[model samples]
Target chain A: MNKKFLLLLFSLLALLVLALTPFIGMEKIPFDTILNFDSSNIHSDIFWRIRVPRILIAFISGSALAISGMAFQAMFRNALATPFTLGVSSGAAFGAALYVKIGFIFSLLGISGQTLFAFAGALVSIMLVYILSKVKKGFPVGTMLLAGVAINFFFSSFILFIQFISDFTNSFRIIRWLMGGFEVIGYSDIYNVIPFIIIGTIIIILLSTELNLLTLGEDVAVSRGVSLSKVKNILFFATSLMVSGVISVVGPIGFVGMMVPHISRLIIGADHRYLVLLNIIFGGAFLVLCDTLSRILIAPAEIPVGVITALLGGPFFIWLLIKSSNNNSI
Target chain B: MSKILFNIENLSFSISKKEILKSLSLKIYEGDYLSIIGPNGGGKTTLIKCLIKIYQSPVNKIFFKEQPIEKIPQKKLASQISYVPQINETNFPFTAKEFLMLARYPHLSRFSSVTAADTKAVASAFDITNTTNLANRFMNTLSGGEKQMIFIAAAFAQGGEVILLDEPATFLDPKHEHNVYQILKTIHQETNKTIVTVTHNINSAILNSNRIALIKNGKLDFYGNSVDITKNNILEKAYNKKFTFIKHPASEKSIIVPEVV
Candidate 1:
């Protein structure tokens, strides 16, 4: 089949899945109430206020994580690298834990204090990784990966320390928040995250050619007329914002970033020009499917969406490892 | 009599307190095909890197077209010179055409796709390098000789005035080694481009280049025409060995026969 045609088919399938997901929940929403288009219809309230926002949040977060993952992988030249590898999620978890421990029961402009602190923590860790990655020469991939793992462990220990000090209720809340899920009530949360997703995606897609050059290595990228520092700086800032933005709202969903890009690379090629858009579609659909399954698997008892993702992604990751080792592809 | 294309004066470089290039100076003119030959760890590759500013030479030391290299933007510099490293390996699978298309990067706009002119240049490069059949083949799957051909084709597609290569024929059989140099020789004879290559294969360098520069311990041990390079015991001093110089059987050119002990 023609590659473009295959892409179009996948895109339409994704759209269909996105459109059909809101109707298949635990409680039966009346079809007429959905079609009624009334201001106070209970069914319409469920559709718009509850289901649509949840679907939108899942799609947005999934797409953001996947795209950021692809960029991080290419930049670091590591197949296993993800947006959260540099302790972004752990930093956010630490911040959220600290917020809970401090007894701050405040909300600013509908944004919780935990979300703000989590984003701040993510930014700090990202800066540290960025600085450590820079040697006298340009960014070294090995050092970046090591520094990321180091920061990740460092922040994780602090998070454990925070949890140890917090009281039961605060600790419970913090733990629940860390197990990411999509329980967004209305359109406001979706609206808040959509802008960051759009801007970050656009900036990254525009530099897709440069990203392709980077896959050839840094010296080749420089010889090909790519401004290494400029491209790296932009990508770093963009991926940082996207990861921080989504994790703050969704509370650090795991493996969606790594799994989605690798799967998309299998279906599509490694050309970032095409890979970026395909990843967005596949990632969004993958999360929506996982989110839907999480809600419906045991009705009235919700599994954290993070658990579903890891459960699905873990096997696939193992299969990838075995396949690569078998074929000596890595 | 031609104007100088590249001028180096008092160039020096160091990595982690160890100097790799000393205050070496040389002048290369327009349309000069120069090959640099040296033993291992003699700063031959580092000299090429310094010439291309990959090692970040000092201010006002290295000049291209009589202008300080630091003053030129990366795109403009890439437009003037192209580099082919000794080992070119990409972890991801890119087709030969796709790999060559990157050569046109310095010439393309930020948002535009590959244009007709770019395609034409790539096609011409394939024809010139005899790599038309390898266009759709994955670069990683290719043999060393095929990959070297594609690399040279890509560098040609870069359309730069100076094409710098480091060990263009490394890791290849004798037939492919000669074939690689033959293709480079054709490019030099057919165009006004200045070609600079650093290689350990002294016979191949002598067969192709117009001028030769022999480096030893980060200094220029010898710099002259290839015909004049065979007279001194420079190779023996540079490599700490004995060499037997003989005339080529067919062309009567100077060729070195290493007297292996």
Candidate 2:
């Protein structure tokens, strides 16, 4: 734990350095001049409009996804499991598509419509999975995951259907939505997602011990004074809320939840406290790095943030399978 | 006087909804060592489950002495009587200490960290079961006998008044089986804790238990002292086979095994 804390501290410091690297390029905006009184106004615009939101988004989304991943992993007791394992991403995507079809309903409502619809969709999907399982005293794993797969497929297919029928303008917008890019990120996204992310992460930290007990299986968990249903309800609700917030704003940016927790578990053991925190830090760093690389890899034409995570995370997941088979302690 | 700690008014079993127990009743007094010997699927486990209130049967009307089974909270019930089920495939790599800590859960509140008392139980449980060396080892890494000792250690950690063991020696080696019986006997003698062991090992029941209640087709066929089970007619009726009681090789103790139909 001490070593992990040190590693996290080191990573945060490294992120600070990378965050500054953006200020020193061909467009070389001096650090202190970022908000100076005399300037071409490029420094303030770059810092406030682009760089800061991008960095903050990186930090918030990274931690939120990682913590949500840890919660899902512990709840399911499966290394491959993530928050979206129960169809949160697909459900949120479907919600966003529904919003697009209705043409800016938020202009009248004057609210962040994506976040609201995403949360509602995610919550409904979670409930749908639980309901579809034919729940007995408690939810069964095989039934729950199967329902998730079915729901995910249904929503994903609906998203594809929307893409197929919509006009070129709407289709291009849908393409960007699906392939997650963060170029136009602003303060509003941060304002919308931060509270849900912070509260959910803290609650998860407090519930870490309960999750550790839950790993011993339901009989042991229930015997240990944890109301099994309450733990499940809290975890599901928190993860859904956090993931829905992120997915609604950023679109379904897959793999942060899937790979980050696994890597964190490797660094720390099955202890959820360190696992959850480390995942957040590492996840944020990884995504921010990927998003930065995507911006520069094509220079003027930024790549989709999701592509880098997909390409890298998919192979890493496969390697985990191979490694875990050899090292069964995983 | 031995206080009646548990009473089973009726707990039956059936296959495909066919009735097995017909309003049967029994009493369990503290400091008593009772053995339940019966045929396969004779509702011994079912009756035990009803007493624990795992199933919602008409037999759930049974009580733990003065209070109804449902009335006593699960944690409180767990404190009074600990149940150690038969060994099965434990696929996960849970440690011995972690397994014992589960017993202390009923004694704890939410967010209440495990105290020195829990550590003491874990240490003593290790000492009692002689799993002190296997403390840090995963359950999957241990031998069957070692694992059985770990389960016994878990039950001991519960600090319950009554210990219910179902075929405890089912997967254990002979030496380990003897150790298990000796452990239970020591617990009964030292703590005066009530023991309810269900087993197919009739000789083990006769040797370790104070009394034997024979069951057939989910009903109590015979109930009496260990000495009373030595008769040919009782053995024949209980086992549905002819048997002879021969003195143990080195001791005055006797064993009754089936001879003929």
DockQ of each: 0.53, 0.28
In terms of docking quality, how is candidate 2 classified? acceptable
Number of backbone collisions per candidate: 0, 0
The lDDT for every candidate, in the order shown, is 0.82, 0.74
Tell me the tens digit of each residue's lDDT in model 2 across A83-108: 56668788887887777766776722
Q: In CAPRI terms, where does candidate 1 land?
A: medium
TM-score of each: 0.94, 0.83
- Segments in model 2 whose C-alpha atoms lie over 4 Å from true places: A1-29, A35-40, A104-111, A132-147, A165-167, A319-330, B11-26, B34-37, B42-62, B71-85, B91-94, B211-245, B249-254, B258-261
* lDDT for each residue of candidate 1 in A65-176, tens digit (9 for 90 to 100): 9999899878866656676766777776677678888986786676667667777887788778777776556554545657778898898889778888888887787778
- State the iRMSD of every prediction, in order shown: 2.6, 3.9
Q: Name the runs in model 1 displaced over 4 angstroms.
A: A37-40, A99-116, A136-147, A321-330
Estimate, for each residue in B173-254, the C-alpha lDDT of model 1 and write its tens digit. Answer: 9988888888888888887789999988888778778899988777788999987777778777778877898998987898
Q: Find the number of clashing residue pairs for candidate 1.
A: 0
Candidate 2, DockQ to 2 decimals?
A: 0.28
Candidate 2's C-alpha lDDT?
Answer: 0.74
